[model samples]
Target chain A: MLKRTPLHDWHVAHGARMVEFAGWEMPVQYTSVVEEHNAVRTAVGLFDVSHMGEIRVRGRGALPLLQHLVTNDVSRLSPARALYTPMCREDGGTLDDLLIYHLGEDDYLAVVNAANTERDLAWFRAHAEGAGDVDVLDETDRWALFAVQGPRAEEVLQPLVEADLKRLRYYHCIPGTSLAGVSGAIVARTGYTGEDGFECYLPAGAVHEAWEAVWGRVQALNGRLCGLGARDTLRLEAALPLYGHELTETINPLEARLGAFVKLEKGPFIGREALAAAKAEGPRRRLCGLRLLERGIPRAGYAVHRASAGGPDGSWEAEPCGYVTSGTFAPYLHQPIALALVGGGAAPGERMAVDIRGRLVPAEVVPLPFYKRGAAAPGS
Target chain B: MEFPQDLKYTEEHEWVRASRDLAVVGITDYAQSELGDVVYVELPAVGARVKKGASFGVVESVKSVSDLFAPVSGEVVRVNGALADHPEKVNEDPYGEGWMIEIRMDDPSELEDLLSAAEYAARVE
Candidate 1:
């Protein structure tokens, strides 16, 4: 049976075209992806992200257990602070990428991908065997997640929560009561889109009322109701990695260009050996951004080829350099951009080809993010 | 909702305007609204023979890709080339400037199988 969020009926009433995604019925779009994408980039947009899995780890050994299990250091996180990290296997392969929130001295909430909830839980259970004083509990069914993202997200959300939204630093979170009467909720200043935003995790029963209340506030502030389609495009433009595409069981966190999150010097960890070896030997492939030089857009799984550097007769020679993992016609850049796993030598400014519809389309390697941050000027 | 009484529609949301031996094809307003903003269109070349109910083109929106099926068997005589650059025309004027293709009908009697405006609207609802 497919699971439904507390706000499922609300989405239906709002005319959302629902589709089965990650074993749950979710809205793919409300109006248009371009419009919603622009809304989040220019103003503010609300999203129902209740499908994400939230797991709570509690006990005295929670911090040490988490530090040993994930790639990031849990000791660095204070109360109400969050860190984005990838949980990897002993072989340095990413099991799941998630955000770890330090709620208190003995309590931490780990938000993981909905599809990987079971796997992540099993992984955590297996690793927590010898670690006494740690108990991992899946709290997904108990919580409803909502995100308000973009320039004016704070303004739209400030009136709904009692917490001082302006004083909250990025990646910090606090427990508060929703204006709609949802209590004991965690409101975190973090988001997938490269915008100033907050993600609220509220009680399941109060989710519907909170969603309506937040929606009313955002609508009053001229924010929009965005869906998964625009969510994907916006994150792609920001160069954020998605699981099962940019992240995989075979793809290590370091090779995914997320070394900043991997704390190798913190102490001994599960994947530290393999990660250190990889660091010493160097990665065979690197993830980079690709900008389409031609009119066609490159899609995921499309072959990326490097034109021959030296050959006689001036004949064009090609070799499979890599493949595109995530791609889209960037609405913000007004051009097609992609994230490709290419060879070491295929650095930025290099020329490449993406095979689309049996035709080789020219593309150029560019920097990680196709779009850059400017002033936080909200649109009226 | 504003389907012209003179036009005919199919269950697949395709609208057909029969003018004797020629037929102008487009999607219903419901289809355009459901598709949202169109970004690209891949139409068959002129003179290409198309079978009834066969895919003759594809329309890509920001979210999904939808196949455009031929409502009746005919030879493609013309296409709306303006959609290549301005695919939003499909969203702006689905029945007029947004017409997908014009076909020289091989069997004009096939129009009898399509639903009238009222019938089509009721079926969609």
Candidate 2:
């Protein structure tokens, strides 16, 4: 059976194109992808992220239990601060990438990918067995997540939220607040899009009316009601890694270029030893950015080969060097961009070609993040 | 979705206009709206012969790809050059500026196989 978020009916009623994504019937687009993509780049956009899974760890030992599961050091995280971390397997392979929010003294919430919720919970239960006094609960059903993103996101959200949003720095959050008359909402200054935004976590039932209040304000500014299509494009343009694409059971954080979040020296975690060994030995494959020089959209699982000396339809036996993990014709950048897991030798500025089905289209290895928004101006 | 009564539509959601032996082909507004934003369009080269009900081209959006089937047997007289850079025209003005190809149809009678605007609308609805 397919799952539907609390906002599913609202999205359908508003002319959103619904598609099955990650076992959920989610809205892929409300309008055209370009319009929603451009809206986030120039103005503001609202997104229903209620499909994301939220797990609660409530106990005195909540911090230590999390410290043992993820690669990042949980000791550095204080109340109301959220840090992105990659949970790994015993062999240093990635299990999932998620956000850990320190809600208060003895409560923590781990927001994980919707598709991996079941597996992640099993992993958590297996590890938490007699480890501490922590009690793990899958709290996904109790919360609804909404993200207001883009430059004008603060302005669009200011009227509805009672908290001072400006004081909420990037990567920080404020819980136990009221927004649109709903209490216990957690307003976090984090987003997958490369834009200034707020992710609000509220009670599931209250989100329906809260969405109306927030959407009404954004609509007055010509903001968009974005969906999974724009969400994927926006994250791609920012080089944000998707779990199945960038991180898998066989892909480690170091290989995926997520080593900065892994605190190896912060004491032993699940995969610290293997990760440290891998770090010393170097990864066999590295994830890098690719820009198609030819007219081809690189899709996942497309073979990446060394550029051939012959013309478009070359007879040369292409050496499979890598494969694309995620690719799209980025609406914001107006070009085809991709993230590929290539051989360890592949570096930026090198020439490569993507075997887009049968035709090998020339491409260039570029730096991560195809786009980033400009810095905010002085106090305006 | 707006289905112009003057144009002919296919069960596959394409729209066609006939002028003697020549036919102008484009996807209906329903088709383009369903496809979302068209980022790339793959069309058969000019002077190519396309059979009715056969796959003639490909339309790619940000989410998925769909094959463009020929509404009628015809020789491809011209392909839409504007689509190479501005494929979003299929979304912006699917009926007018978004016309994809002009075909010297091999059999004008093949137009009878396509659906009328009202029929196509009912089928989509």
Candidate 3:
């Protein structure tokens, strides 16, 4: 049986195409994926992200436990700031990448991927045993998370929020605020879409009313009721890593191009020794962006190759070098783009090919992000 | 999802419009709407041989890809080249400009095996 969010019925009523994702019945899109994706790029977009898991850790040991479990320096986090980091196993393999929000002194909330909820909770419990004075509790069902993202996100949400939206800096939060008449909501200036946005965590029981109120303004601005499809495209365009695709149990932070979030110098963590050694040796396969030079959309698991000269009949052939991790035809760029784990020192501007259904399509190694906000729009 | 009375439909959600031995092929409205926004299409080369119930091409939407099947066995006389640059035509006008191929059917009588508009509509419903 698939789990359903509180907005499942609402999504169905609004003509959303529901699909099973991560063992949950989630909305994939409404009218069209491209339209929803473009809406977030040009205007405001609302997302029902209640399926994400939130685990709470409180007490004096919270800071120490967090610093030991995650790759980032959690001691730097304050009540007003949030941190992003990747938790790993003993051998430097990624467990999951999550955002840690400091709800209070010695109290923190770690938002994790829905699919990894059970495993992550268990990992936390096992580590917290005999660590110190700490209490780890699963708070996944306590909140309904909504992401209001885009250039006009603030304007769309400011009217219903009590706190000053502009005052909340990026990666900062106001733990207790009123949103759409709901008190004790957490409004944080953070998002995965690479947009100026806010993520509001409303009490689960009162979420419907709050969502309805905020959605009214969102609809007034012609913003989109985005789903997981648009969310995936938006994050991909911004070069944000998806756990299963870009970061996995076998894919280390360094190989996934997330070294900035991994603090090797930080005193001993679970995977500290392995991570430090891997860092010194340098990653064997580096994740990089690939843009198709010819027609053909690359998909995950497709073999990436070092392009060779065409055959006599102009047939394409190449030697395998890597494989694509995540790819799609970018709506904003109007071109096919992908992230590939390339080996043997593949550099930007090097010619490559993606083997698509027995055909080798030409491509080029490019920079990470396929799109960035504030940059000139395509065809401008 | 409109199933034109003049066209024959297949269980695979493809439609065929035949005039004598030559047939025009395109996916049904139900198929295109289910697939969502079309981004790319792969079509068979002109003069390629296609067999009934065989996969001939590919139509890729933003989120997924679907195979285009042959409704009837024939030789591909032409393909809609415009879809190479404007794949959205498949969603905008699947019956008109979005038609995928023109096939010279080897057995014109095979059209009798296809479902009528009413039958196709009922099957989808």
Candidate 4:
């Protein structure tokens, strides 16, 4: 049986195509995937991300426990700031990549991937290491997360929320705010779509009113009731990593191109030593962007190889250099783009090809972010 | 979008408009809508031979990819050139402007195996 969000019935009523994702029956799209994707790029969109897991760690030892678990430096985060980090096993394999929100000196919330909720919680419990001051609570069922993302996110959220939308900086959150007449909501200026947006976390019981209110303004602006499909495209265009595909249990942070988030010198963490050793050795196979220069779209698990014409059956005889982690015809770029784990001397501008189905389609390695925004507003 | 009674369809959702030995082929409206926005399409060459029920092409959206099956066994005589530049035509009008290919039928008897519009509607519904 699939789990249903509070918005499941609403999504179905609005013509959303629902699909089972990560054990939840979530909306994949409404009218179409491309329409929802483009709406987020050019205008605005609302996402019912209620399936994401929320785990709370509060106590005097919260800071120490967080410091020992994640790859990034958690001590640097002041209250209201959010830190993005990779929580890893002792051997440097990623457990999950999550955003840690500092609510107070002793209160912190780690928002994790929905599919990894149980495993991540178990991992946290296993690593508690007799920290009696820290108390970990699974608070996922208590909140509904709605991400109002895109260029006009501020305009759409300002009227509905009590807090000053413009005052919130990127990666900061304001607790004790009221949203759409629902009090005790947490409005955070954070999103995965690489847009100026806000994610609202309110009581699940009061979420329907907020969603309806947000949907009203969104419809007036010709915005979209988006789903996981648009969310994937938006993140792909921005070169953001998804957990299962980009940062997996075997892929270290360095290999996944998350070097910026790893604080190797930050004392002792569960995976710090292994991460440092891997960093010193240099990543052998790196995750990089690939643009299809010829026809055919690259799909996940497709073999990527150095260009060769030796094969007889109209395919490459060369062994695969690597494989694609994620690929799509980017709706924003209007071109086929992919992110691949490439090695064996494959670098940007080096010739390569993705074995799409049975045919060898030419491609070239490129820089990350198939699309880039022009400018960002202050504190937005 | 209406499925015309003049065309025949496959369980895989491709539609064929047969006229003697030559016929035009495209996906049904249900197929295109299910596919979402068409970002890219990969089709067989003009001279390529295709067997019924075999995958002759690929249709890609921003989210996923679906294989395009040949509705009838034939040799491809013409291919849709517009799809290279404007693949969204498939979603815009799967019947009229989005026709994928025209083939010289090698076995007209295979047409009898296709589903009628009513049958196709029932299957889709």
DockQ by candidate, in order? 0.53, 0.75, 0.88, 0.78
Question: What TM-score do all the candidates reach, one by one?
Answer: 0.91, 0.93, 0.97, 0.95
Clashing pairs in 3: none
The candidate that achieves the highest lDDT relative to the unseen native structure? 3
Q: Per-residue lDDT tens digits of candidate 4, residues B5-27?
A: 99999999999999999879999
lDDT string for model 2 (A195-268, tens) is 99999999998888788999998999889999988999999989989999999999999989998999999998
Q: Report the first chain's TM-score for all candidates.
A: 0.95, 0.95, 0.97, 0.95
| CA lDDT of each prediction against the hidden true structure | 0.87, 0.90, 0.91, 0.89
lDDT of 1 by residue, B4-57 (tens): 888989888999988989999999899988888777777889999998899888
Better of 3 and 4 by lDDT: 3
Model 3 chain A lDDT-worst window of ten: A368-377
After superposition of all CA atoms, the RMSD between model 3 and the true structure is 1.6
- Top candidate on TM-score is 3
Backbone clashes, candidate 3: 0
Model 2 segments more than 4 A misplaced: A308-318, A375-380
What DockQ would candidate 1 receive versus the native complex? 0.53
Q: Which numbered prediction scores highest in DockQ against the true structure? A: 3
Per-residue alpha-carbon lDDT of candidate 3 for residues A39-147, written as tens digits (9 for 90 to 100): 8888889999889999999999999999989999998887978999999998999999999999998999999999999999999999999988999999888888999
Cα error of candidate 1 at position A96, Å: 0.7
> Compared with the true structure, what per-residue lDDT tens digits does model 4 show for residues A176-243?
78998999788999998978888999899899999999999888888999999989988998989999
